[model samples]
Each structure stands twice: as structure tokens, then as C-alpha cells.
Target: MKTDPTYPLFPICAFLGFIISLVPISWHFQAWNAGTCLYMFWVSVACLVQFVDSVVWHGTLNNHAPIWCDIASKIIIGAGVAIPAASLCINRRLYIVTSVKTVSFTVEDRRRAVYIDLAIGAGIPVLVMILHTVVQGHRYDILEDVGCIPVIYNTIPAYPLVFMWPVVIGCVSFVYAGLTLRAFLQRRASINDVLSATTTLNVNRYFRLMLLAFIEMTCTVPLSAYSIYINTSGVTLAPWISWSDTHFDFGRIDKIPSVIWRSDHAFYVSVEMGRWIYPTCAFVFFGLFGFASEARKHYRMVWMFLAPRISLVRLNPRCVQFRIIGTMP
Candidate 1:
């Protein structure tokens, strides 16, 4: 297997992202809403999977751990859908908070909102995972330094079954984000009152959440669109096919030679983009929320909890040396 100089960077970035994404989840566990938590959870999962996959398969195409690859490949597919779905939940929540006509939200209304967010954030991805079996071309593909990836047949059914959800969810997220922005602009004077009355959002947190949703949608839509175009362009398939033919053709399934991927430019670009997207999102999330006042407080709490123990450990070595010398004398 041929190696690329850049292969090593994938694990490093993915590992960093996995760690950075976990900070908000662990530190601000109670502070973040379900949507934000779900978003970070998917990010963490994707990054961790990439980190492990890259480290194991770096500069090699051998399927050393086929079972791990199988599970990771499914996760890779689910996470691609889950992240955008979570963004939609966040945007939708903001839109509701900003556009509500009622002056106060009831407990049932808050509970209902949480339920909807959870449904969209968690439910849709599970549905997509079930749907993906229809288009899954083969068992999986193991690329040099890229590890195992799901093989989706680029066909008419794959458009709706696999490729379009991210773009579609992203478009919906964009609409919600736009409406939320418009509502925020129109009610800037009373926005704080509305937020305090309706939800746990403060002005800064509200702005950051809105901005994060906007950014994620903006990135997700176009990237997904481009990916679809690249995957489908110049390829001709029957315009219509029977479900049996298009569905996972287990009878004809076989391993693709790893060397073939080395020369497939389009596939390489797609894989490269997929590898970087989660880490980039993680970095962006860290830039946005990693240093906020609440995050800083968590950091201080962690330091305070660890500092005494660390000091005692450091002092114990010297104390041990002194005790040994005294005993010898």
C-alpha cells in the first residue's frame, strides 16, 4: 500500500477533536440543552472513530480488524446524518424561543420541546441507519490509511436513501436559522425578556447557539450537495430499478481491491473531506464555546480538584527519599 505524508495528520486531528468535543459534554453537562449535548456527542463519536480508524489503518489497506471496521462504518454513516439533524434541533429550538407569541412557557411546553428535539436529534439518524441498508453496495471498503468506509451504490435510490438527507436537513436548518435571525433582529429590544421568560437561554448563550447552528447549516448543505454531485456525476445507471436489484445484493457482494482506491481521485476527495469535516467542526465548537465563562469555571473546578492531589504526589517522592535516608542512618 502506498502511503501519503498527510495520513498521520488525520489521527492527530481526530484525536484532538475527540478530546476537545468531550470537554463541553463533561464540564457543562447540566448547562447545555439536549440539542447541544447531542451535537457534541455525535462529534465526539465521529472523531473518536476516525482517530482509531486512522491509527489502525495508517499507511495500510489490510483489513486487520474486520468486525471493528463493520461497526465503525455503520457509525460513520449514522454520524454523518446525526450531526446535521442535531443542528436542525438547535435551530428549531432557537426559532421557537424567539418567535413564540406567548409571554410565558408552561412546563408541558418545555417538556414537549425537549421531546421534539430529542426525536429529531436521535430518532432521525436511527431511521437513516435502517434506510442505509437499502443502498449499501457491499460489506465495506478498506482504503489505505483511511480504514473501512461504507459502500453506498451511487444509483437513483441512493439519492433519497443516503445522499440527500444531510442536504435536506441542512436546508431545513437554514430556514430555521434564518427565521430565528429575523425574529431576533425584530425583537432585539425585548429579546432578553422573551428568552428569560421562555427558556434557560441568556443573551450570550442565545447568540452563540444561533451562530453555531447557522455555521453548521451553511457548511453542511453545500458540502453535502457537492458530495452528491461528485459521487453521481459522469456515472450512468438505470433510471429505475427494482428494489430487489438495488437493495443490498448480498449474493454479488465482494471485496474491492485496495489498490483501486489509490487512483480514484473522486473517492479520495470525498474521503478526505469526510475525514476533516468532524475535526473542523470540533475546532469551531471549541473556538465558540470552549472558553466561555461557564467553561472557564469548569476548567477552574477541574484544576482545583486535581491540584492538591498532584502536589501531594510530587511531594511524596522527596518525603520517601528523606525517610529512607533516615532509616539507613
Candidate 2:
């Protein structure tokens, strides 16, 4: 019927997504992952739009923030919600053609695509958020400092916990990335033969998702592993005011550090370095690849395998064609 209830759910979804983005931001001013940062940037603009929309037309902030927010806002809310929202917006034309043009696809197939997007886009993020919330809430007294605040939870303790966050993030990201990539590839293969520039562009759109997933996982995994290594073995003597040193003594209380020296776990620095290196690569690669991919496909010359872009890249090509049901020639 009416384009799968997006208008009704858009407001709820947008606020939740914004809240999710704020979580990492609360973790103290470290840079957000590439995807999240972009999403957040859009969200800020979206929030402003909502504010303007309400003030200009007597709309309330509570109702406005999410409702007026962009589609990227929907996707960030969670994979379950985001995926369907993306699908509805992404494949609206396809669904319309299927209905009016008498395309061979069953309504069930259309629904399935919607379901898959929801599953991948919303499901993955929700799962990770849950896991992180439950198992990774470490204990660290928030302190005012110039550098970023360290999260020190049992799941992220120096010895055993350090490895937890990175590993969890890495594993979740790895699985999601792999599945998303496979799906993108499959979609690309299916649509590659369609000569219509529109079809090609639609399919190629999926490539961006694959690239995004790949960038997130690849960038974060090694960092996680390195974090685990540093947390486990790299125990450095704390400064005079370190929480550990203040609360518990490791028998070196009297020796104040005139100079800092590496302990047995100094090699852990290398692991931390590796983590940074990999994600830096991912960050750089994602930026370059996205720019290039969009440029190459700008005229709708290539077959796309993923959903279309909302910003930065545009694939709204007119070549997207539709054939009536059973009318494939």
C-alpha cells in the first residue's frame, strides 16, 4: 500500500539514530569511525533543519529532530530500521514499476529486499550496541584532561579487558562487512547485464555499502587486536595520581617517576601503532574510493550493485528503466 509506513516511522527512527551517534561522542572526544562521523555530520544539519521547520511552522523540537532529519539519520538509527528505510527510498521506483508494469517479481520478493536491508542495516548496529552496553561498561572515573578519556571496564580492563572492546567491535564488524560485501557482489552480478545505465548505477550503489563495511571492519580490527595486546601485558607505572596507583600499591609506591621507562610489555606499543595504521588506511581508502566510484558512475554508465547514495555521491540516473511483468525481451 502506502510505501511501507516510512513517514510514520521516520521521526522515531531519526531520534534514536541521533542518540546512538551521541553515545560514542560521550565516550570523550576521540574521532568517530568514518561512517559514524559522516552520519553525525549529516545528523547535525538534520537537527538544525528540524529546529527551523518547527520554529517556522510551529513544530515542536521533540517531534522535529527526527522527522525532518535526513535518510542517513534513518540508517544510523539501527540496521533493522535503517535497512527498510533505505530500501523503501532506494527501490521505490522499482516497486512501483513492479506493481504497474506487471513485472515478474512477486510482492514477496520486494518485501524480502526490504527485510534484508532492515536486517543488515539496522540489525547489525543494534546487535553491536547491545553487546557493547551489556559487556563493555568499564569503570573509569571521568576526569578532565586534554587527551581523550580512557574507557576502563571489566570487559576492557588493562589485563584481560583491554582486548574486549576491540575484539568485539572487530568481530561484529568483520561478519557484517563480509555478509554485506557478498550481498553487494551478488547484486552486482545479477544486474551487470542490464544495459540500462539506471540499472547499472542502482547495482553499483551497493558497492559503496560493501566499501563502507570493509572500511569499518578493516580499519577497526587490527586496532582492537593491538588494544587487547596492550591491555593484557603492557602494564606501565602510573603517574603519581593514577587511579590504580592511588588505590592499590604494586610495591613501587615510593619511587616517583623522574623518567618513564618501558616495562616488559613495551612491545604492546607496536600493537597499538598497528591498530592506528590499519584504520588510517581504511579512512584514506574509503574517501578516495568513494570519490572515484561516484565519478566513474556519474553518468549512469556502469551497473551498480547496492542502494543509491543520499549524499556526497549521486546516482539518480534516468537510465533506470522498468519493464512490465513478463515483458522481458
Candidate 3:
């Protein structure tokens, strides 16, 4: 393994991204039980751990972070795989189960949607992981410092890390896409139909946001497939990044430097680069596209909360007070 001076920079930026994402997430924590929000929250957390493990914890420290972070990270890694599928399925169900004449969904339907999404988002991966543990070995290679990779990648009878999950997600996405296209056209059959919906229900916005979420998820599929291919085909696409800060006894040499070193398995490093991309894009889309009013409200709320005293300024001494309209009073 060769050293790259730029490697540390990648994880540093990724860690900062995960940290920044937490702010909006904090604002939305009370919203987890809402439809799609719970799955999205878990997915965000999974991305956070991916960044930490792949980039930040680069030494013996990797082996010794808070235990929950480790456990949560691994479980949600699989949960992330099922998230988009769960989202699309529930969204399509909402569209179908709603009043076609009224063009609106019910809160009761949304609550039920939450349950179905959770089942798909959390259930499939847990079952697969359990099956893997019983059929394969332990998921992580702690003795060799492989971190939290599935043993299915390198075990005998070699189950793929990618195969069934991608197939399932792809199948679900395809069905969702077809159904959504038809729904979109039927609802927008004319400007009257659209304006009628705008005045009465405005349910189209929910569908649009669902479409945006699917688009973002679609973009991540290629990267995911490549990672899977590498593992399944037994190709060492990348090297392992070991926790290099540990002391190694080399018999002849007194000690080995424990700083960051390029190890085997570069697949993880490459995948980590894109790990934050999907969650980041999805979060931004949800904020601006789905929760535009809420985002603006939060922005204004924060601005006023922070700078309520600077609303207007006095330019001159002789009763010359001018109200600052836009910014920087």
C-alpha cells in the first residue's frame, strides 16, 4: 500500500458534512415517526457512521469508538439499502389509496404508511444479516481489522454484498416509476385539473417530492452496483484502510509508526466518497423541495432569534432612523 497525502482530507470534509447535516436533522428529530421521516433519519445516521469509520477513525481508535455508534452504523447500513424502496412503495400506496375525486391524502393513511415503510426499511436487512450470520460467519473481521464488512464478501460459498438487495430495490423502483408517471399525467390532464388540485388539495407537491427522492436514489445506484461487483467477482477494487496508529512489534524493528497508512481494500474508500452524496442530496431536496415553507420559516426564526435588536439602524443623529429591509442592519 502506498501513502496518499490527500487521503486525510477526504474523511475530514466528510466528517464535517455529517456534522452539518445533523443540524437540520436535529430540527426534524421530533418528526421521525412521521411517514418516511423515520427511515430517512436512520439512513442519515448510517451515512454518518460510514464517514466516521471510513475517514475519521483511522487508527486503533477505530476499534474503540462509542459502542452504540458501531452497532447502529452496521444495522442501518442495511437499512439504508431498503430505504428508497420503502419510500417509493409507501408513496405509491398513498396515491392509490387517496380520494381520486378530492385529490388529497388522509393523516390516517400517512400513519399507516409509516408502519409499512418501517417494516420494509428495517425488516429486509435485518433478516438478511441474520441469515448471513447463521449461514456465513461473523460480519466483521475484528482480528484482522477489516472493520464492519460482511463476511459474505470473502467467505466460502461467497454470498454477495450487493445481489439481492439491488435486485429488490430495482424492481420496486421500476414499479414505482411506472405508476408515478401515469399518476402524474392523470392528475395533470389539464391546467384546470392542476389548478383545482392547487386550490383544494395540493397533494401534487407530495408526489413531486417523492419523485425527487427517487431521482436522488437513482443516481446512487451505479456506484452501489460497482461496489457490489467488486465484492462478488472477487476483485480487489481497493485496499483496506487500517487503524494505523497502533504499535506493531516487528521483531527486528523496535516499533512501527501508528499514523494513517494505506492498507488493503480500496473499495471502502471509494464507496465512502459517495456515501454522503445520496443522503446530502436527499436532505437538501427534502428541505427545499418538500419543506420549503418550513425551511424558510426556520431561517427567519433563527435570524430573528439571533439578531432581533438589529432590525433598523440610525444613519444620522437628527431623527435619521432608517429601517433596514433585507439584511445586515
Best by lDDT: 1
lDDT, each prediction: 0.80, 0.35, 0.47
Candidate 3 accuracy as TM-score: 0.64
lDDT per residue (tens digit) for residues 170-254 in model 3: 5566566666656656656543454354332234445544565466456546655665565556453332233231111211111
Among all windows of ten consecutive residues in candidate 3, which has the lowest summed lDDT?
245-254
* Candidate 1 Cα outliers beyond 4 Å, as residue runs: 26-28, 101-103, 247-262, 312-329
Give the CA lDDT, 0 to 100, for residue 26 in model 3.
Answer: 41
Pairs that collide, model 3: 238-265, 238-266, 238-267, 239-264, 239-265, 239-266, 240-264, 240-265, 244-258, 245-258
Alpha-carbon deviation at 145 in model 3, angstroms: 11
Candidate 1 backbone collisions, by pair: none
Write the number of the candidate with greater lDDT, choosing between 1 and 2.
1
TM-score of 2: 0.35
Q: Tens-digit lDDT track for model 1 on 100-207?
A: 865566668767877888899889888888888887767787776777888777777777888899999999999999999898889888887887764467777888
As a whole number from 0 to 100, the lDDT of residue 3 in candidate 1 is 56
Residues 85-173, candidate 2, lDDT per residue (tens digit)? 22222233232222232224455664574465444434555554344323222321111110011232332223232234445545655
**Residue 309's C-alpha lDDT in candidate 2?**
36
